[model samples]
Target chain A: MPAPQKHVIGLVFYPGMTSLDMVGPHQVFGALPGVELHRIWKTLAPITCDDGLVIVPDTTFSTCPPLDVICVGGGLEQRAVVDDPEVLDFFHKQGKTARFITSVCSGAEFLAKAGLLEGYRAATHWGMREQLMTNQGVEIVNERVVVDRNRITGGGVTAGIDFGLTVASILCGEETAKMIQLLLEYDPAPPFDAGSPEKAGPELVEKAIALMQQMSSLEFANPVR
Target chain B: MPAPQKHVIGLVFYPGMTSLDMVGPHQVFGALPGVELHRIWKTLAPITCDDGLVIVPDTTFSTCPPLDVICVGGGLEQRAVVDDPEVLDFFHKQGKTARFITSVCSGAEFLAKAGLLEGYRAATHWGMREQLMTNQGVEIVNERVVVDRNRITGGGVTAGIDFGLTVASILCGEETAKMIQLLLEYDPAPPFDAGSPEKAGPELVEKAIALMQQMSSLEFANPVR
Candidate 1:
């Protein structure tokens, strides 16, 4: 009978993070009515995304409110940030109170590093699935979206749409998520059949793995975050 | 042999534009090697998207260079922007020099207004398919991504990814586009079948049409730009 209470969602944006990992879900979650969204970072200064796109943070780490949900996106810089005590501590503190703790792509690594994904089934970017498996006490599931209780995780890049819709259904309802899906015109029609390594065949997958390896090596040699 | 020259891509940004409409292609384009990317607008100011996300423009309309490719995304603001002579003229000027002039979703409407899509087969958001067909000289096709010579148009929001990859193949070659696809891990597995009107069944499509109508009306009543 009354107006729906505003739900606050905090989206973590870091230097060199993937744009689609966050923006995909941002487009979906932010479209909901009475939603309070915050793009949180250590500072309010603009942060360059993994691919050269620039995004300005809407809220500082210190000023960010206790969120109903927290989402972290992944990119080339995830390897370096896993050791940042500040980020890990923030995740630990927020994960304690947030209704749902979520991650997209390599963002799961941050949660895995923070011990949030320990003992819970999770999903990460398939390219980095091997590295994620090295994390002790975490179970890796192969799916576009993986949901275990309050911990929700989406696979790499574009999977954020599925992740957002699944979570929206849980938070709002099936009708709401479906409506948002329509609003997004989310009927995906991928022109190519080569979205995954399996679909791409061995040759393309080999090249992709080599490229990912090269990127990781470059990140270590010349860190962006 | 010297290194290949950077391919400049200027993506048009405007207030009330859909974030994913631009960000989707941006992630794909920015991932390419030697991509000199520019997020151009009328001025170098922060603009709010149709959703709540805020993005800062990287270049101004006056300062934008002769680009290899120019992309424009769409949203509720399409109606008002199509009437702006400066924007229409800017598209006209850029279309003359740019190798490829492209658009996503209702962004095709602006190109139509500018007379660039005249006599070209184009794709647009299905919800606004009728309005786009009103252009006497333009041919409206229902495909997700339509490429007629140098004019490339994508259907709806999510189609930008497909559009980007298809264009990338044209510009950089299929190998580069395929590599980028693997890197992005773009294996899309939508949990719902209701992405398009035909796929979404009659009831959902009816509701989606009504929602689109509501959003356009709301935009007219209270312009965000």
Candidate 2:
């Protein structure tokens, strides 16, 4: 018989989560032969993504099996993530049981608030780097991905795919990760050169900032205490 | 008043649809401002992706509004996409109503089968190129994206993102697409050199072909008649 599947990945989804944060990595992890990918949320019912793409969870938070890896994504509804005691409690509990704990973009802020990032190096979306820096005992990194001990972190939404692949490599060996990467052609070509604040011209970055200003104010008012 | 929130884009989803085909594009399209994205299915209930991620539809087929653009994805469930008269009827009707009709991977096949591709130059997932060719008047191109009049097509799962951004340029203007691309920092770095059949080394290509051969019997048995 085929070798028993060795690992299971649990991806936590919440309302307003960035679809790419889950999808980019889901493609990488699902491609593995012995891996099972689970979408987890408060309920098994379908959850709407930030942009309105609705997804159903494979398991509700209460029903999730022991996970080898757990990934939480972030987006416009981050306040919910930051303030939901049940979600924070769940992460705090699972972070101890799981082999690895990971977060993409502002999700790291949630992890940090749960006290999981204490004394660990982490990465987050560029927009939130300042917020991360203020957290005690967390060494914020500017790299696209930062791996400290068993905690893996990624910058912003798109970087989740890269971080997921990196974690897959660490858990399953580089060969498996490479195979999945090859299959998906993870190499991307953008017609334009702007993705980061630094690369995006000042004018474009300003637009992004202006667009996000209202949301940022919400974040400030609802800071994780 | 603000430029009246441009327009909304509606994407159709169904059971067994390739998640990447839709999610990849959702990433790019969902990030834009003045644009609302919706996931529409026959029901507002949750659906499972071909790879196991479950998604909820924003609107039922009967409720979806007149859309600015409609994208239909395809996968192993091509038969369902091509043969369901209700689905075909919806595509046909929506194709005429929407400003653009688009698809990714075997999604092009659905368009061709619906007679939407008559006189159109299209692209699809390489795996389904031959199948698409059997349809009269459908010009299958090998490029990553094909644009003919109002129909836009992408080569495969990952190609959907590229195609979405391309169509974004056409619908919203090149500047909007460029800004979003920069925000995504859409630069991709694939660790493996083999992404396409032509570029993947001979040995790896042979391995892929061998894998494909295993699926040939299934394909022949399930050909959409």
Candidate 3:
């Protein structure tokens, strides 16, 4: 009798990316049995997340093995990552045979930029819809987690949890995913109902937009779609 | 005009600790202006989370500055951390003056072990309630987030997000916290309703407890209180 094959999941990391976006899904995937997670980067150096937390990547692009799951997480530096050919090429090369190519938040931008999301319906952080819509042949959906064939994209940072569970159910089984959710005690009770633009109203939407604009010089006055 | 004083937040990190438990709150605190978050540990070496993720700590126990917030996150290694005198001593010294001393999940056990949560109402991961209840002078509450005076605790792993937002609102006002929520798009949409033990039912609860026990040799057959 042979041992069960390991599920290798490579999560792309870059400087200024949202630590929560990647860490949320990473935590979820890490709970599965026989699953190996790789924090992949261009180099093996420490990557500082946008929130000042630092993460050390375990695998470089050159050393990352063929992955069952290739996931990208978003941050204010999405525009910068989109233009980096090295990252895009890595995505293009890995997307060819990965069982799942996924993203959370503006991470969808990198997949779209790499031409992986072309002709696929996807989701991203609300503030990034306007910019992501610019990619040809991509249809951005306003959903928490979108699963179009093998491409699964989550909306914004916190949605990574939902996206991860969805993927876990797909890779393992619904029973296993539900058990993982239970283990994490993932029953969420957000204190405020202002999670979305519609729920937050105009004042908060404006404030959120302004706050995002202040975070970076990106043209991010995206209206609720 | 004088500069606004920075809010120093120290999040304790130990090997095999849950990354999301720390990162969720870290991301929220990092979004605030005039806030400094320190990933603190016994040494400056990279700490590997239980899920195989590596995080680089910027501050050590000896060098961490006076903190406005001192938070500990839970993991399967909670018992080992509780017995670690170095970590408990750091918590004791820091808890003396920190405005808010907090924990998420079994992290409450460390605070309890350090004599910080004495006579305090707190929350913790649902699986550890039996053991945590044995801590003298501590009253465990079964809630998502518990705020008893200056001691705040969150239930289980994913509750860290709610706990983070609650602390953010308390520190920086609800308006600013709301904006941060919008930026993260924290609207959660869990695909399954099996988050809590009651909601997850008997079969899943047994599975979750078995899974947790398998992670370590901890005595964790805690029934919901």
Candidate 4:
């Protein structure tokens, strides 16, 4: 028999995490053959996504086995992640043993704060670029995804899926990743012309900021920094 | 105050479902402002996706509230959905109350089985076109997505995200949907040239089939049809 598959991807889920950031990658990684995907969260109790989608973890952090790859997604919950020493310690300790460490969107911020991204090239949600730059020794790249060494970082929330596929290709073979992509039919066509910071004109981008500003009160209540 | 945004989207999640089929749409719909995306499952316990991706539900069959849109996703679960009397009854009742009733991939098969697709143009995952065409009074379309009256259908698993955005635009406004798409940067670039039956060459398709055939025993043990 072929060498028993050795990779086990451990994905961390917490309350208020962006659903797509986790689920998008989950879909891509889970599709691979001979690989095991584990949803690792603080509790076995169902956790709700930032947008109210609920999911149950396959294993709690306390019981999770050592992972080959450890991924942490970002969202409004970053405040807790940044402040919780236990979470930081977990990342620092577990990341040391993992062959690859990855983050999506603001998740890179947490890893950076945890010292895992020191002297590393990283990517994060455009909106949080400034905040991420505040951390010392971290080189921020403006791209959909960045892979420097064994650490992979993705831009914003949806970029996690693309990042996941790329990581899977790196871990497995390119053929396996390509096959999974075909199975999912990931070709996308947005109805509108706008999707990128450059594509969404200044006015639209400003409007998006204005809309986000309206939620400033809530944002201040839960600042990630 | 602007009428308390009360848009409700009922997402049908069942056993043996392809997690991505429902998840792709969930990410899109959940991103909409003032929208409540509910995972309506048959039971309160966690439901596993085709490849062991498990998700918990916000509401169960006995307690789900009325919906503005009802979205049914397909997977290996189609066999159970097509034969379950209670599931059919629930779909019929929910379809009557929902302003829009939609399906992704083989989910159209369930809608057709429920007698809800009669006199409507529908779409299904290419692999299940013949199964969808057999339904009486259902006009099968080859498009990635099709909208007929209050009925909407999408092809395959990943197409559900596009369908969900289309439905979000119709229900909310094009501007709102565009804003969300822009925020998410919904553009995609698959590394491979294959995704659809047309685009994926006969050789690659045959290879895919051969790979699946290798797992035919498992497929039949958990057959969708």
Candidate 5:
């Protein structure tokens, strides 16, 4: 027989968001038994990510049921999400009732802008951590994954896997998460040691920041639907 | 002005393929200058992955231009691909011209079925390694990333990232690949030590193999059109 109560997860998507930030966590969450995982967006249309990959949303913000967990991801396009009131409103409305509010990379910017992360210690994309600290009124952590109360945030693109496993452990216990980790072959062997600013050194980090700033300057025409 | 010659990388997608397998490499290759990354399948229609994620191919096999590299990802859906003649034909056709042929997880099965990996030493998902060895006429390499002449293969799901960076270093210089590595925050920190069969212990490995076998039995309705 089906479980009497069901758990639901809603992952938010928008144009230009880093696809890995979303899909990494999805590989963990979607594997849970009897858990309803919904890829939510403004509409059901296919959205193009920063690198030209196309992803289709499974549901819309308006039609999705009350979510147990709401997750968001970030990219250069997060600027548009920060400026969109409808998305902020959705986060706010959902934050009040959701058991956990989470983000990966700059995805936290939306929650922080929505005032959901006020006085909360969180993590963000290393490149964007300073910006979030300076303006978002939240204490920032530079670690891979940070969980303050129900607000969990992860560092840049690849941190999503760590973040996903952390979230999976919380929702379904350590054993289940460990099993998923093994299945995904979560052991990582980076051929380089430049994943973070501390490791990449100041010169390379500065170059990366400039590249990111240049990228963010490009306009994304994603309006609130 | 564009480079005199463009570098083309085509990653194949189909129903039930793992999304991360395709995307990890995409993140690396897509960042290179003058590099054209095409998500190719039989058509431009959306293909549902094993995890319910939908991906749209950028080009069709017939319309896709010549490729310097052709990549594939694997999952339970890969069995269907091995049984499809059209997909096998495409691999044989592309293998004749592509400078590099690659796969992640069980995706090597497609190339093996196409007779392209004959006498090649390759890697595949650990769970499916024995089957591949007993049947396919290819020597097996038990490692995260294996390179045998023009053929490169990665183990299991998450090895795609390392495989991607390896390929990136070959196409571009190490400096460029390292820069992309930093941009992607390629450093991974999985919270568990159970990523491999030895690490997860024999009991968990047996359980995992059973689960994988159960998963691979489901038929994917991905008719070659």
Candidate 6:
């Protein structure tokens, strides 16, 4: 008997991308049977994330295979990523025929730059909503995970788990997805209730925004990429 | 003026380990100010996680500096890792003066083997509870995150996020952790409630257990050391 056909997933890698945003979904998709995961970057050199975690890409643009799903994670470098023609071209080429074009956090901005989110309702990190809206024809929704047609976008860093599970259910079935969830022990019990701007209150929200500004300014005086 | 002292954190890495288990806490701690995160492994070679994600260790056992916190994430290789004398010695050396000793999921088993969890109430992946109990003097608490003295353990994969945040709050303060929480946008909304055996029902749990068995059998013919 022959082995089952594989579901190839390509997660785009760029310097400064948030590690959790990519890892959440990668863990989910990589758990599925007969699934192949490719960490695609322009080169195979190690990519240092925003938080200093270093991940090595498994595939490069020239060597990447056709993908059933193409995912991108977000970071402070979203604007720089959107401006990169090489990355945009890669997304355009792979996303044109991909069954699913997905993003986590400000990764939606990259998809939007590739014209994939045009006229599509999407979700993104709350902090990046205004920036994402700058891309015309995209209606930004403030949900944890938004799905419209084949475009799936998740909110902020931690929402990737929900987004990944949702996509897993779609790709496989609920039973399989549920089993994966159980294996992951996806039950969440946050110690604090300050996960969002509204829940975190005005003071915290202001501090969080300022924190992002500080990080971006300090770390990206010259973006690594 | 001298810079504030850095809180150095060491996350143990091994082949066959779950990526999410390590990535979750690493993301949270890495977001904090004056915190240095270390991915310590046996070598500088890239460690391929169970889900196929490749992460490069920033430090090695012999060269790793003193840590404020020592963390181990769980995986199928937990048993093998516990048996490896080098790893145990490394844990022992670092665990001696570390302010906090921690684990996520089955990673608790490693700490238990290192005698770090002796006589302490801890948490681990639900699936591994029975196995973890075999280690004498340790009380396995079935909570999302468990804190007993300086020993902290998280329930399972996704629980690492909550665990990380809790630790962050302790290391920094409520305000800083809250800001990190909001920055990560950790408002979790799982599509299904099948995260635990009770919520997943008997049939689903059986299937999950069987799936795990199949994976272990097929993937660990020799068990990648």
**In DockQ terms, which candidate is top?**
3
Q: Quick one: ranking by lDDT, best first?
A: 3, 6, 1, 5, 4, 2
By DockQ: ranked, best first: 3, 6, 5, 1, 4, 2
**Per-residue alpha-carbon lDDT of model 4 for B48-135, expressed as tens digits?**
8776777888688789888888988877656756669989888989988998999997788788988899999998776667656766
Positional deviation of B82 in candidate 5, in angstroms?
Answer: 1.7
> Candidate 1's residue-wise lDDT over B84-150, tens digit each?
8888888889999999999998888888888899899999887767767877489988889999999
User: What are the candidates' C-alpha RMSDs?
Assistant: 4.3, 4.2, 1.6, 3.8, 5.2, 4.5
Q: Best candidate per lDDT, number? A: 3
Tens-digit per-residue lDDT, A4-104, candidate 1: 66789999998889999999999889767678999998898888888777888989889999999999989887666777999998999999999999999
In candidate 6 chain A, where is summed lDDT lowest over 10 consecutive residues? A216-225
Using lDDT as the yardstick, the better of models 4 and 5 is: 5
**Which docking category, incorrect, acceptable, medium or high, applies to candidate 5?**
medium
For this target, which candidate reaches the highest TM-score against the unseen true structure?
A: 3
Instruction: Candidate 6: list runs displaced more than 4 Å.
Output: A1-5, A217-225, B1-5, B217-225
| Top-down TM-score ranking | 3, 6, 5, 1, 4, 2
| Residue clash pairs of candidate 4 | none
lDDT per model vs. reference: 0.83, 0.74, 0.89, 0.76, 0.82, 0.87
**Candidate 3 structure quality by residue, lDDT tens digits, B81-136:** 77888888998999999999999988998899999999999999888888888876
Q: On TM-score, who's better, 2 or 6?
A: 6
Tens-digit lDDT track for model 2 on A84-202?
Answer: 89988888888889999999887887788889999999987766777777885798887788889999988777787678778878877765665555445444555566667667667
Q: Could you give candidate 4's per-residue lDDT for residues A1-225 as a string of tens digits?
A: 787477899888887787788777888887777778888877788887776778888787678888889998887656666658877777887888999999988788778878999999998876667767777579877788888999898887778778878887898877777666666666655567666667766766666656554632113111112
Query: Cα deviation of A172 in candidate 3 (Å)?
Result: 0.5
Deviation from native of the Cα of residue A23 in model 3, angstroms: 0.6
Candidate 1 vs candidate 5, TM-score winner: 5
lDDT of 5 by residue, B172-193 (tens): 8777778788888777888888
My TM-score estimates for the predictions, one after another, are: 0.93, 0.88, 0.97, 0.90, 0.94, 0.94
